[model samples]
Target chain A: DKKKQLQQLDNFIEGVLQEALEEFKQVE
Target chain B: MEERIFGTECEYALFHQLPPPSAQGSGKTAKWSGTSFSENLQEMSHLLVCALRGQNRPLAGEFLANGGRFYIDRGSHPEYATPECRSVADVIAHEKAGDRLVQKLVEEAGGLMAEKDIPGRLHAFKNNHDPRGNTYGSHENYLVSPRAMEKIQQIIPFLITRQIFAGAGKIPHLAPPAFSGEDWLPFAVSQRADFVEHVLSDRASDARGIINTRKREITRSGDNVRLHVILGDSNMSEYALKLKIGTTALVLRMIEDGLGDIPAFLQPVQALKVISRRPAGVHAVEGAGSGHTALEVQSIYLEKALGYFSSHAATGEEKAVLCLWETTLSGLKNLRISPSGVIEDDPGELSRKLDWVIKAWLLNRAREKKNLDWSDPHIKHLDFRYHDLDPETGLFERCASLGLVDRVIEEEAILLAMEAPPHNTRARLRGGIIGEAWGKDVEVLVENWESIRIIAKSKVDGMHPFARQRRSVNGLKANLNDPFEGCNEALLKRVRRFLDKCDEV
Candidate 1:
C-alpha cells in the first residue's frame, strides 16, 4: 500500500515539475 | 524559567515575469523577464504597502492585527516578522500566515497594477536568493537567558549541521564544490551558506555568519536576550519550520541548563559552505570525529537534547521536535546524490516533510527526465518557480494541491493566524492593541516591537485631564516590556479613552 502511494507521489511530482518547466519555457 | 519566546522574520523575494513585446501579441500568460531580477518587483512591493488601510508604524511597515509586522526591508524585499510564539505549532501557523498575508497583498497590488495597465504577473516568492546571486535572509529570534548567551559557541556545531534538514536548497551560479574547476555543483543545501563569512559577526548584510551578534535586550531584569539568527533559509514546509525552530530552542535550553562539551567545528564558516555544497560526501565534522558527517554532528546534538529533556520536563512540542529531528537525521542518512549533483536517491517520506529534500528531488527528477544537466536554464526556472506563491503556477503549490507534501499545521489554523495572534503570549496584547487601534479615529504609531502610541483625531476630549490642563497631548502609549504578559487592560482602557472621544468616529 505504501509503495503504491509512493508511486502515485512520484508521478504527481514529475507531472508538476514537467508542467512547470514547459510553462517557464514559454515565458522565457 | 520564563516562558521561552520564539519568532521568525522572513524577507520574501518579489519576482516579476514581464512578457516580452513579441509575446504581448500572443495570448499566452506573462512570465519572468529574461533578466535575473527585475526592478518592477520593488514597485510592485510598494503597491502592496500602499494598499494597507492604516499606518501601523512610524516606519515604512505596518504592525499587523495578528501581532506581527510586515514591512519592506533593504533591497525592497517584503518582510514579515511573526508574532512571538511560545509553541512550535504557533510559529509554523503564523509564519505560513505571513506568506498568505503577502500573497493577499500581492493580489491587491496586482489589482492596483491592472488599473495602471502593468503588463506582468507579480510573483512573490518565499525564498532567500535570486538567480543573480543576491541573498536575503530568513532570520530567527529566540529569547535566551544571559547564561545561554555566554556559552553560545556550544551551539555552533549543531547549527552548522542543522542545514542537513533546515536548508531551503538553492541552485547557485557560483557553486561551491570541495574541489574547484570542472567540478560543477548544480545545487546546494543552503541559500545563505556562501554569503556567511564568519562564525560570530555583528554585521548582517556582509561578513554574515552563523549567529547574528546584534542583540536586543528583551527584559529590564536582564534575564533574557534576543538571539537574532541570520543563517537559515526561508522554508515552505511546515514540518521543516517546526523542526528548525523547535530543535534550536531545545539546544539553547540545554545550553542554559549546562549541556556543555558538545562538538565544535574547527573552521566554522568553511565547514558550513563545504557541508552545504557537499552533504553526502565523506567530510569529517571536526572536534567530533575523524569520520563524523553532518548527520553525526546533528545526532550528537539530538542525543544530548534527548538526555537533558529526559530529566527536564519538556512540552509536547519539544518532544515531538526531538522525534522529528531524529527521524529526519535517519532519513538524511539514506540521502543519495551523485557527484555531478543529480539526486541518486530521494528519501520518500522525508521529501514530503523537508523543503530541501523535496526541492532537490524535484530538480533532480527534472534533470533526469529531459536529459538535462544541473546547469540547464529550464531547471533553474523550475527551481525559482518552486518557491512561487501562486497556487496555480508554483511547482511546490502544485505538489501541495495534490497532497504530495506532508503538512504539520491545518489550513484552518493558518487562516485564523492571518487575523488572530497566539493567545498565550504578549502577541495577544500586541494584536489586541493593533486590532483596537485599527480603523479607530486616531493617529497611531507602533514605535517598535515593544510599544504602540496613539493620539485622538479630535483635540479636546481625547486629552487626559493633565494634558488638557497643559494643552499638551502627544498620545497614549502602551509599552509591553514583558513578552510573557498576554493581556493589558490598562492599554485597552487607554485605547478606549482616546478613540471614544474622537468626533470622526
Candidate 2:
C-alpha cells in the first residue's frame, strides 16, 4: 500500500509537460 | 401543410480488440503489431458492406434494403444513415434499426476474421470522441422549409440547452489529472460540446460547428433546406433519442409558423460549454439573466412551445412531446448532483431516462465501491463498454436486459424497421425497389440518396439473343427528388418495366 502511495505522488507531474509543449507548438 | 422529413446519421468507430503483447502490460489494443487499426478499419468496413451485400460486389456506396445508407464515412468511420421519416416514432425506430444492423454487420465481420485466423474480437462503438482528441459525428437532419433559415437564431439557445437531456455523456479514456478532483466536473454532459469550434461552419473535419452549414445532399425541389445538426451524441437510450428529435421538431414547427421573439444566446459556444461542463451549477446565460440552471433555459423554450401548440393545430406527436417536455423539466428540477461526483437526488427518474444521468449513477456506484478516481482505468473501461453495440456485452444492453434503463420502442418495431422503410416518405419507394431488385440477382447502385442506377446482373456466357433488350434497360437512373413522394403506381410501373426487360433477356 505504501508503494501505491509512491505512484500517487507522481500523478500531478505525469505527462503534463509534454502535453503543454505540444499544445504550445500547435499555436504556431 | 405536408409533414416534414426527419433523418439521422451515425458514424461508428470500428475496431478489433487484441490482448496486449504478453511482455508489455500496456492496455488492450484494437490493432496488430505491424499495421495500425486505422488501416485495418477500412478493410473491416468493406467486409461489413460485403457481408450485407452478398456477392453483389463491394461498391464504396451501397444503400441497404431498409432504405438506409451504410458506407465508409470521411475517415474509418462506418456510418449508417436512417431513411427519411415523417413521424418521430419512425425516426427512433429506424435509428434503433440502424444500430441493430450495424451490430449484426460487426458480428459478421468478427466471424470473417475468425475464419481467416485473426486474433481479436471486432467491436463497433456508437460513441463520439476517442482517447486521443479525435471525434466522429452523430448527426441529425431535419428537412425545413427554405424560409425557416431566416428565423434560425431563435432556436440556438434551445439547441445549446437541449444537451441537458440529449447528451450521450462523455467520460474520456485518457482523462487528465487536471479535471480529476471533486471541485472540477469529472463527467461531461455532451461529448461533442467542447469540439464545437464555431457557431456555424461548413467544415466538419475542423472548425466544427453546432449546426454544420454544409449541405450534405442537394435538395433540388420542394424548396427544402436540410437543417444539419452535428452537435448531438449518438444516444443509447431510446427515450433520450425520441425527446431530442421530438422536441427539436416541435420548436422548428414554431419557427416555421413565424413564431419569433425567442432569445438567442449572446455567446452560444460559451453557453454550450457551461451547460455541458456544469449541468447542476448556476448557468451564466447572457440576456436571459444569470444564475439560471440548464433546466430553466430549457423551460423557457418548453413554455413557449406549449403556448404555441395550444393555439396552433399541433399533431398527436407534438402533443406527446409537449407532455414529455413539461414532465422532464419538472423532473430535472428535482434532480441533484453533488460536487463529489455522485448523484445525490434523482427523484423524477431522469437518470434512467437520460444518458448522462444513467452513466453518472453507474460511475458513482463504481467509485463508491472501490474508491477510484475519475481517471481510473476501471471507470474508463466501464464508460467505453457502455456504448458498445454488442448486446451480449455492452453495459447499456446489460442494463436494458435487466430492465434498469427505460425503453421507448418495442423489439418488434425495431425488427420491422430493419427490413422495411418508413411507410410515409420517399424512402418507401426507394426501399421497395432495393428490396425487390436485390431479392433477385439484379444489381442496383445507389448513386446518392435521391438517385438510383440499376443494371441487369448477368453472366458473359449467359448472353443470349435478347442481349440488346437488356442493354436498353441497363444503367437507367431513377431520380426521386421529392422527399414526400409516395410509392405510387407510376414509379412502380417504371421499376417493373426495367425488371421485366431484364427478365426477358
Best by lDDT: 1
| Model 1 ranges off by over 4 Å | A1-28, B25-36, B54-61, B176-186, B217-222, B282-291, B340-348, B462-474, B503-505
lDDT of 2 at B282: 57
Q: Residue by residue across B412-441, what tens digits does model 2's lDDT show? A: 999999888888777888887886675554
RMSD of each: 4.1, 7.5
Once model 1 is optimally superposed onto the true structure by TM-score, how far is the C-alpha of residue B373 displaced, in angstroms?
A: 1.3
Q: What lDDT tens digits, residue by residue, belong to model 2 across residues A1-28?
A: 5355324322311222111111112212
Estimate, for each residue in B1-505, the C-alpha lDDT of model 1 and write its tens digit. 3368889999988876665556563433343344335466677778889766422322213778888989888899999999988888999999999998888888778778778777666778989887666788999988888899999989898888888899988776654344443323457888888889988999989889889887665454346888888999889888888889998988888988898687666677878887777775445544545756688788888889878877889888778888888888888888666667656676646778888888877787677767877666677887887898888667787777777789988999999999899998778887887676666667677777777777766664423553574465646667878887787787677567666655334
Candidate 2 fnat reads 0.00
Task: Report lDDT (Cα) of residue B409, candidate 2.
Answer: 82
Clashing residue pairs found in predicted model 1 = B17-B31, B17-B32
lDDT of 2 at B412: 96
Docking class of 1: incorrect
Second chain TM-score, each model = 0.91, 0.91
Give the 10-residue window scoring lowest on summed lDDT in candidate 1 chain B: B52-61
Every model's DockQ = 0.19, 0.03
Off by over 4 Å in 2: A1-28, B23-31, B34-39, B55-61, B172-184, B282-286, B289-291, B439-441, B457-475
Each prediction's Cα lDDT score? 0.77, 0.75
